[model samples]
Target: MMPKKAENCISCAVKLTGTGFTRFPCPDCGEVIGRCAKCRGQSNPYKCPKCGFIGP
Candidate 1:
């Protein structure tokens, strides 16, 4: 089963709030990942907590 969406940004560990935050499944593990708008805009890399899959 797919993992639930994270409440904090995976890249920066910031609480996910307001608009522009995003949640999507990890390509390797189907685990949900969360990203804040700042991190996404900066192209910061994030690692999946479940499978260690990293992405830009």
Candidate 2:
């Protein structure tokens, strides 16, 4: 069977799968960033440390 994995970060659109996984949207789940990659590194998603330059 195929294992299920996070596909997109609720904050940033960074692929929660392969290559993009290197970086994560929310360091952990249950959190939201309300941003995207192009806006930062990914898109329609968040990077990390929402308390940083990231947005609300």
Candidate 3:
């Protein structure tokens, strides 16, 4: 069993199951960002507020 952690989708800010999200390192910084499956499936663009980097 796994805990249901909450995480905000980087592309849409929707609350998603942490286990259902994807974590990747920011290209500009080493910080990690979380993207939900819905956003990733739709190729939604996301902007990293910390580094101002935008991408799908």
List per-candidate RMSD values in Å: 2.8, 7.9, 6.2
Give the candidates in order of lDDT, highest first. 1, 3, 2
Candidate of highest TM-score:
1
lDDT of each: 0.90, 0.40, 0.71
Best by lDDT: 1
lDDT of 2 by residue, 7-48 (tens): 454454555543423333344543334333444453333344
Query: What's the CA error at residue 19 for candidate 1, in Å?
Result: 0.3
Identify the runs in model 1 with alpha carbons over 4 angstroms from their true place. 1-3
Pairwise TM-score winner, candidates 2 and 3: 3
As a whole number from 0 to 100, the lDDT of residue 49 in candidate 1 is 91
- Assess candidate 2 and give its TM-score to the true structure: 0.21
Expressed as tens digits, the lDDT of each residue in 5-29 for candidate 1 is 6888998889999999999989998
Can you write out model 3's per-residue Cα lDDT over 1-56, one digit (the tens) per residue?
31233257777777767555787767986556778988888888877657778877
